[model samples]
Target: MASKLSTTPGEILREGQLEKRSDSLLQLWKKKRGVLTDDRLRLFSRSSERAKELRFHSILKVDCVEHTRKHVYFTIVTIDYKEIDFRCTEESCWNAFITLALIEYQNRRALEGFRRHRLLPIAYEEQEESEEPRSPSP
Candidate 1:
């Protein structure tokens, strides 16, 4: 999967260690190095087999589940109801960066939709004007 990671073209928004919650009772956390892109967030472990990618569209919601003096914990809830935890120190603050990127992506999508809607009406009007015959000037 590491080879496939290079296939996606996007600016690196953030990169750091992200902890995955393994168990509820024990509250075990597994640290994974990750890089967050504009479209997706990819986490890589010691082995390529453990690589995981989380597409922005697949993310249903992102919430700051916990905040402490040392680190802030973020819970990224996916469409499939899978919750992934990421921890960032106060200096890095990856949580805010990810949230802002998601908001920007949504805004761009909305703007594209708006442009498409307006373009269709203008196109139809131009077509109608072009099809009509113009009267000869005296």
Candidate 2:
């Protein structure tokens, strides 16, 4: 069966606009919450703080990273300050690149810790995709 046509503006409004909004850097900047300047002394004193020697401004710079999924998976890219937290007064130079690098570095460290504790499994994924290329049959 064929789909019915929109007879009026009200009919079209029923489904709402079909357009998808593009994500922008400005949107990302605005979405950032909780200023990193709340409590400097307390933040620096945290034992989990990996940015002990590194200056907070130095961490403003970002390093590009790309990770491949073992299976078909969409990697979640988020800036979370759990292990390595840095706070700088330089709001003008809030380099997102450094944040990405810091997060990845922390992730690697966590993975290593898990391995040392025997928390990681040798074989994890059940549905392992074939890595061997299949030749076309005539």
Best model per TM-score: 1
Q: Estimate each model's TM-score.
A: 0.77, 0.22
Q: Backbone clashes in each candidate structure, one number apiece? A: 0, 3
Encode model 1's per-residue lDDT on 1-138: one tens digit a residue.
021222245878678776777657887777778888878888887566476888888887789988899988889988899887777787777788778777766666778899999899999999999999999999
Model 2 error, position 31 (Å) = 27
True-vs-predicted CA distance for residue 85, candidate 1, Å: 2.2
RMSD of each: 5.9, 22.4
| lDDT, residue 118, model 1 | 85
